[model samples]
Target chain A: MENDDTEYPVRYIPASKVLQAKVPFLDVSPNIALKKANNVLEEMAKDYVNWVQEDIKRLESTYQDLCEDPKSKDAITALYRVSYAMKGQGGTFGYDLVTFILNNLCRYLEEREEFNEGQLELIELHIESVRMVITHELTGKGGEMGKQVIMGLKQMINKKG
Target chain B: MSAKMLDLSNINILIIDENANMRIIVKQILRALDAHTTKEASGGAEAFTTLKTFNADIILTTWMMSPINGVEFTKMLRTSSDSPNPMVPVIMLSGHTEARYISEARDSGVTEFMAIPISPKSLYLRIAEVVLRPRQFVQTNDFFGPDRHRHDNEKYRGELRRQEDKEKQQDEMELTDAHNSLLKPD
Candidate 1:
């Protein structure tokens, strides 16, 4: 159980390195290419951060309501859609971490009919993992948030205690 | 699960393009066809990440984009083995009229293509064709998952028949062994 408050799970992939490895814009002017590339990187980070913010707000207001109700299928469906939305965009923009987290989120939500309290807790942990990545990446939080999220999820998912 | 137009209410479509006006126009077309859910991605990377996270039923992207072009994005997606709904039809919309470019798009796993300035009627019909086309090939794990969910009820029936054949063979072997013992006639 290494869920220390000091350690976060967010990992950073440098934008320059990502551009070199993943996308190389050819036939476009250098300034235009860099501008386009940077805009994409910035927008993806911004959009993801905003999406998590909305999710957090929704959870705060409706968490108990959804958890207690059996007919909250719409709420569950919305959550799955959010994760699936991330799945489509994350890998293309070089945010593999977000892509991976959302994918796990999708799998968890897909099995919602069979989800137990423990599995629900893991979903929360996965959300935390996403928040951790977004907070650090967006604010340049000097890496604290990432460690907290990473360690929290590791504690939840790691069974070899 | 009904094949009728009203039954697909749960489907969310992702439309990728750099043009805001184009996104809105396409959304309107989809909505006209009873598609209520739509998400927009403005660039290849954003579109890529969105596709990775979203459980969208269809993806309509333009070939010309800044940063990561549509061709490159499509190529990258085709390489991923863990992509959910790998068989999800991707229809590329391009303004390019060159035959060379069209074939290139086809070669890159683009299920269908349409010229830009696409009319509402054409868009609707193209979408219907893509969604309703008969499944002829093995949508194996060559895509992300088994083509079990997206396949029509008829395909599932065929799979069930294969399973039944295996079960019947097992039963016949047991019966044959019993008959052989009886024939020994001790």
Candidate 2:
């Protein structure tokens, strides 16, 4: 390798050994660690059914606030943050539809401003769809209805965008 | 190494997110992995305070936060003179997996980006990568943090650039030439 030592503003620090010394690789099977972790998530999923309702309520209230003041950039951004949480949690709890819906919503909200009537309505439709999924315990793919809801949302996103 | 298990219990890890529930979820997952020492903070400010004494080896943070967000927190960790464990690996957690969001986190010095709705497998993989394959840290006039490049002749790790960086890099080449002269066969 050429020593391109330009008197550059860059300074390179060697990789830190502070953590490595403590987290050394051991002979234990990776499967054991993975199994333990999966167990934890499986346990959490049980309560996720109840916890997700609060998230939906927060999502609804944020949407309502955005509806009241469509011009408020903060309101729109806050709404997105609420959706962000749901997007992360939904899949872990078997609410893949919620994850899918909120994931799409976050993309729409990213750097988005000026929510026209159609856009707002579309947003509302998404929230309601998510609510329906959770309320019905539509876990895996939500079967046929899940397909329809996801397809409908995609179409609306195209039109709204 | 492939057959070996990762030991997370020996090292301290920090969880920083505004959402309490997310913190719990991450903590539980870490616990399952046998992580014995872990700390939690509500947001960036709390994270800084926690850093004062915790000496965390890894930091898992959320993207969107009130007051000071993940990006802001990362910049501080990389640049702040008083920052505790400034070289600690930062893994950003965000449900928004958009390129822009991930790029933004990377630009600000995140060591790893984990798009959320996270699974135990994905989470474990991320932790394993950061632990097993730590990246070199790079500091420049404009940015300071983990070298962004995974490979390639130590390329400039920062995306944010200035006219001066170009000029400064030119100066670096001149210095490199001078240093190379010592290696020449006379």
Candidate 3:
């Protein structure tokens, strides 16, 4: 195994010096041509919906197993992986509501030391919120209702902790 | 030259993400930047195989991929004798912004870290940062990757400024000595 003290024979140039000396300005023009990119993203998102629904179903079943056997690390890890993927992809595909819910869910899971009834309920609520987001096609406009759901979930998590 | 004038048409980028949708999003963004020759890998294991033939100029990968995660892949790319180009720059993508995760990616040999929900501007900035202002690679017994420190802006003043300056000067002198020795008539 490699340790921190291992040394190699190379000198590094700092990014700051290179930026100052070589490239002072980074100019990126907004590509007007790619403005229609959103339409393409929407189409791809439509296809992703089916996959995401299937993932949710799997998560729901996993949650049930967790409730039955709370000590199952595999169930928690499986739930986390699916939620983590959704957390990363939802906003990119224009499903910001899903992203919002999943991001919080992932955070909660990360902070979890043990799975309890309260935690399970919160997870269930989060899963249901995701379902609602998908079924309603809640993109960026999940506004008030979405905010309330997130707020309620947060309160529940906080109260339990 | 400004980023606008910089032509990425000649640059070949390899994007490694588990999600097909992510690959599509990244490809579109790179296309907008005028990078036409882009390749995609479903996961890290496939990325290693693709690199054998793709000869990619830069690699953009996600933090979490099945079979082989980004950190493990980066370690292999940096140290494995079989690596096609061990020094090829790597940029890690992820939604997790926690300091621990960022620090982990840095230690694992990633050249850059980009957060998810990436905007065009942010993506362009990261690309420009890597290409225009490349960091020097460091090779340690345990690590072979870009230097961790990135900022050189004059506006910022921190407590470690003087110490960092001294370390940098010492490093430069050592490098000069080594170079001079190489040129000596022995």
Which one is best on DockQ? 2
**DockQ, 0 to 1 scale, candidate 3:** 0.20
lDDT of 2: 0.79
Docking class of 1: incorrect
Which regions of candidate 2 are displaced past 4 Å? A1-7, A158-161, B151-186
Q: What DockQ does every candidate get?
A: 0.01, 0.40, 0.20
lDDT of 3 by residue, B56-155 (tens): 8789998877778998999899889998877777888888777788888889888878888765545655666676657767765567788776444534
Question: How many clashes (backbone atoms < 3 Å, residues ≥3 apart in a chain or on different chains) does model 1 have?
Answer: 32
Clash counts for the predictions, in order: 32, 4, 2
Best candidate, lDDT: 2
lDDT of each: 0.54, 0.79, 0.71
**Per-model i-RMS:** 26.1, 10.5, 12.2
User: What is the lDDT for A137 in model 3?
Assistant: 72
Between which residue pairs do clashes occur in model 3?
A6-B141, A27-B3
Q: Kindly list the per-residue Cα lDDT of model 3 for residues A5-83, writing each as its tens digit.
A: 3344444533334233433322443343234444555666777778788778877987787788877877777787778
DockQ: the better of candidates 1 and 2? 2
Candidate 3: how large is its RMSD? 9.8
What order do you get sorting by TM-score, best first? 2, 3, 1
